[model samples]
Target: MSNPAPAEAPTGAGTAPVPHRDTEEPAFPAAADRSQWRYRPRRAFWRSRVVRAVAVVTVLAICALFILGLVREQTGTEGFLVGLGLAVLPVPLLMAAFRWLDRVEPGPWKNLLFAFAWGAFAAALVAILANSFAVRWIATATADPDSADTLGATVIAPVVEESAKAAAILLLFLFRRKHFGGLVDGVVIAGFTATGFAFTENILYLGNAFGEDQEFGSTGLGSVTAATFFVRVVMSPFAHPLFTVLTGIGFGFAALAPRGKRLRRVLLPLAGLLLAMGLHAAWNGSATFGGPLAFYAVYGALMVPAFGLLTWLAVWSRQRELRTISGELPAYAAAGWLSPAEPTALSSMRARQVARAFAARTYGPAAARAVGEYESFATTLAFLRDRARRGTAGPDFPAREQELLHHLWQRREVASPALTYAARATGRVWAPPQYLDYDGYNPYRR
Candidate 1:
């Protein structure tokens, strides 16, 4: 979805600020007429110092519930160990996958878990309740026509299960709209929710497979179970992510899309959801057919394309920042706040990384980190500029937004012990000498 329009200034407050069009001028924070503001585990609690306490408690409670279930079942040694193994292996991988794709501003760990926990708890509960009845009703109506178990598996699970899982994305939109900055952010959030759902769902499937194996003898089910696991968990873990990302995209569009473009906001995410459902349905259909042709058709026609499209979109979204920097740095350099060579160096992603690494080399680890932060903030500003160009904003209306964002860069630059401030008395050697002069400071004579 698109970004929103710039806020209009009050009648007495002079002209409203216009967000800039496509030129790559660094959006220095112009002014804020107004200011605004996983999963893992049992072990996920320990990943960070701050959240560790709550995470630990949450994990223990989950573990206790599982342990109690085992105790009540009076699971034999083999059964219990099988259940435990089935449960634990996926947890680390699920968490690691979330961590892997979460390169964007690392989001609220609590929110990640909220998505995950919702899937694990609410989705399952609701699916069981709703589908239980639907299955029974359908069976009676059709005299086992729909087959209750099949209905639960095919129909109820996708809708109720997906909606409950997607509720996490909705919650993120409701509470932390700012976090849902763009489509990619939406993708990440969607992805986490999916990961959470898949993690929990896999446990049942995998656990059942194990339980069945013990009760009925292997009968080659280990291979069948492993194959399903590979397809669902390994091949394209994006299945759940794909579904919930639609909600995330909707939320992002709602917060950011231009004033009159609300229709697009509604439509785009719905389209994404439709696409997701189609993929889910196709996969189900193919699996239902259960032959080599079905396998090849599902993988070739549906799964691969979905995976490729999302991958392309993610990369395309990421490249905009680089392109924007390439476009805007000249304007900043002309303003004398950015040096000539520096702008070129920071324009490309590779170059920006090099520049960041260069700062690290010259200044040290702290400077490197500073450069990284500065680049991130700068890249985001460029993205906003692009959004504004597409009429996401009113006009070049957000002069203050530019100024505040620039102020962040300024602080980041200051944090970089290696590189000196650009708009200072001293000048770089290779560039033509320039001077900084504003209302208070004058470097030119009348």
Candidate 2:
């Protein structure tokens, strides 16, 4: 298809002349004329983002200090050191897996970091205190500490811990709504939160186990420490993440629902929370119900299947996001906002990587960074338009669209040629016949 004709610049007093281009049309108005599209928030000093950020950081810092003190107190110095070392083994792997799933439209690291911190410190503190209080109350009322502990593990712990972890998801959903978009976003955030929770919990379990080993004078593979390591680290590092991801999927579907459908939005997440609690309860009760046989049965029959299904759903949803980008961006392409090949090229991760590599090789790292930013802006634009079409976008849709278009326009000179080259190299789309003649060809000219 032929490129769209450049839009005629509007004539008016005080307007700067639009710069001339030989090959491509400007996507929107000239940068100098976009004052109308800018958004400037007007808030009091106390309500400003900097103030709010400081407040949040302070609260989280306090929570971190308290939780660290509590864990260290219980584990003792030597046991705590051993537990910290062992518990950290699975964190990187889990974080990497969740991050890989988020490659299509990655959210800010700050959001993920906040989720992890919330889980590790705030959520853990809440679960420990609440669960301990409830169990003590139950034991006092029923005069049976053993049954109270059993009830706490099966019923109270699930409710408290899942709710605590879900608090991080809820906060992100309510406040950082932009980043908590779809299934994968929800899954990744929940995974991080749960990973953090598991990290702290593993330290406690492994530390207590080490203490038990010291008490029993055992120092080898057959000791309590080795068993705890095998069970918590190797056998089921994904346990907590699996449970929390159910709740995340619920929130994901809720995010996709229209704003007018309040009941559906609320009910979806509640249902997911209930499912998460049920699964968690079952897993916790497995030993009490039927020992190793029951634990293995639940792991094999329920957890494994659920994990596999969720993994498939997450992968399928990611692929669907790419398809959405390719499908939606062509309209902008036809309107001169993007080159004809970009929609297709941006749809493939391979092409995007190739584009960045080509830019780095041809024009240095800054150009590669520009190309990456262009891809991100383009993806955000596609999602915004899709949300608008579905009647789920917020009131700032027009302003946001303009902003994204401006960013894409700024980087297109460097990004476009690299993407075009990537498209050609990957055989996603061929160069136009007029541009194929090497005698007059200039790939970097746009």
Candidate 3:
């Protein structure tokens, strides 16, 4: 028999009263019940307000310095402006692609913002300085500046740049642990970080290329600037993001690793980083082996296949996430916390979109936002329950699960009917029969 939970002592002004057993528990405790009153949350170092403020200030300072350095190094303010404008062209497209991949359980905007900032600012700055120094040192030792530049690009640059980009993923995995769940999340975060890094690097290269064009009196389509833009922008926008995504995938596996598998958790991300660095090195070194034709051959043969494979992997992972939601949320539905058709609706991206649109149409944009929040919370709740079932849940699992349930309950009046309608409208076979009249079922009308 399990031990009874400790009783709380009663209070009075004159004397101590008799203690009474508090024999209560949540309907789904998720794990064995413990005296929750004694469970205080652990305070982490980064949670401190002062630490957070200092970290923000430090990152801002780094970004400022990097921007200033880029402007100074590029020369000719006109070229810098042109490069800045041109470099930004691919960013939104890349971001949209990653965001689409993460639609099943979109991560927090703050995490994505941090990844971008860290890549564009901190990572880029470190790469630039470290690569410059390393290349110079190699030139001095080898006494062949041309060969040194090749070495810098193929060897030093890849390691420096990929490691710098991976730092953003590492930080998120460590600090924003909740949001760094599974493969899609890892790929999305890494892709955004790499995109930002590429954006800054593109500005530098394009600006320098433009400066070279101005030196040679070349203009228009035949110029070095045009070639750089075509190569970096048009031909291979996904180059940097593709390389860094390996590292992110590694971190993703690490995140999904069961607790206590310390070796797997540590080694997987490292292996991913090494693979990223190797791929980046191969891409850089390609040009050295032969002419542009050779580089293109490697690109078509290796890079294209790798990209296609990773894309498939990311899509497959998203499908798996949807299946997990479909499989897990039915328990909550049975518990009456969610509608019978809600799990099926939540699993379909098309249904989710329809639900949000329906919510907006019925009760304005605020209702749509509530519906979106409900979806996120419900998805999270499903994942949490899945984790609990697998015995990998942390101490706060019950609290977090309850919190998500509470959010869903608050928004259910609007979200439920919308989702139910969505399931029916989308022609999902599992859609509950009663939900066909969802419009007439006013849940809030007590």
Candidate 4:
């Protein structure tokens, strides 16, 4: 019996029209015979997208400018310049590390950029203002400045800062829910937010240190600037990211929960946020509660171990994503939506790399790009299907699945042969079971 055909794309006010197909064609039509599907989003859709884009950009830009002015006012021009230079050193490295972790099912750069900008400007601005106000209010109430400072750092700062950073994750989780799939996505987005926050924090600290050093006629290695750099930049660059990632993990878990399980969805993120706050408070109180020894003890006993564990969890989650792709795509393969070998090739990072390289070598950069897009769409499709099976998929699942299939179909000519070649080259080729019907019963459904 011939394999069952995949669902046709649904047409609507904003969606593209379904392409015509010959009734006599096979379930998986020949590459040349498959009609190319074009997505022509309606003018209203384009207008709304552009308007939202502009609004977000404008808000971020305004926040950035205000924060820049505030920092400059506090730190002299020269100090700001020095701080900026030093503060930027670890940013690219941190971003690269997070992006690398997200490689399996890479998110759009726009999400990452939004996370970073939100943390660096919007969140930072909120933290600084709210923290200062809280400290002053406590100082006035208690008539003890030092104690107010301590409480602000340990209690007030953690709550405010973590909440501010979490707003970015929360917004994305609600609005860009489709992209916020699982734990790794959470970790990556949280890491980017924390990295950006740390970047701005470092600049302020370093700039103030530089100003102090200038006032005291100190320079070189023995200066306040050097000490600040060594402590904040060299020693604890990952501190903020580690704290924020806990919150991200919480949101990630919540994302995986079925919509009907409302309590699980709410409690998971709250728990994550609480954990993040506790850790942040402990780290901040270290200096006040003890001294340098206490700081080192916390770093070694808590921070380092926490970081390592999260790192392992993130990596394991990425591997599980690949496994999910490998497992879930076979049903589609058996139904002729995908080539028999495509799932195996797409699941292996090495095979994927080889496929892209082969495409570029044979058909140039455009073909390579097509293959990359095809891979992304296929990976997303697998995740979407997995969510559907788990009863966690959103109302848009059918439309989204059809859109992904259309994109995959468009690029199959460039992607399929290269994937097949890479599968054989990498020794990962597999023959999907010929008679499996997903609609009736799927062994791989779980």
State each model's CA lDDT, in order: 0.56, 0.86, 0.82, 0.86
Sum up the clashes in candidate 3.
0
From the highest TM-score down, the ranking of the candidates is 2, 4, 3, 1
For all predicted structures, in order, the TM-scores are 0.68, 0.91, 0.87, 0.88
Global fold similarity of model 1 (TM-score): 0.68
lDDT of 2 by residue, 1-446 (tens): 23324322222211212222334554356554443445545779998878988987888899888887888899898888899999999999999999999999999999999889888989998988999999999999999999999999999999999999999999999989988788998899999999999999998999989998999999889999999999899989999999999999999999988778899889998998999999999999996778999999998999899999999999998998999899888878776668788999999999999999999998999999999999999999888777766667676665677668778888989998788888877889865554465435445343
Q: Which stretches of candidate 4 lie over 4 Å from their true place?
A: 1-47, 430-446
lDDT of 3 by residue, 1-446 (tens): 23222222212111111112122322332332333432345457888646885887687577758665765566568788888899999999999999999999889887887788888888888888898899899999999999899889999999999999999899889878878778998999999999989988888888888888889999999999999999999989999999999999999999888776889999999999999999999998888867798899989999999999999999999999999999888877765677788999999999999999988988999999999999998999777666655545565664565556556767888999888878878888443354343447532332
Per-residue CA lDDT of model 4 for 1-446, tens digit only, reads 35434443332212222223333333443333223332333457546767889999999999999887888889889889999999999999999999999999999999999999999999999998899999999999999999999999999999999999999999999988879999999999999999999998888999999999999999999999999999999988999999999999999999988777899999999999999999999999997798999999999999999999999999999999999999888776765567778999999999999989988988999999999999999999889778877677655656566667666877888898788778877878542344664334222222
Q: Is candidate 2 or candidate 3 better by TM-score?
A: 2
lDDT of 1: 0.56
The best candidate in terms of TM-score: 2
What's the lDDT of the predicted structure labeled candidate 2? 0.86
lDDT score, candidate 4: 0.86
**Segments of candidate 1 deviating more than 4 angstroms:** 1-117, 219-225, 243-256, 289-293, 328-330, 341-343, 388-446
Better of 1 and 4 by TM-score: 4
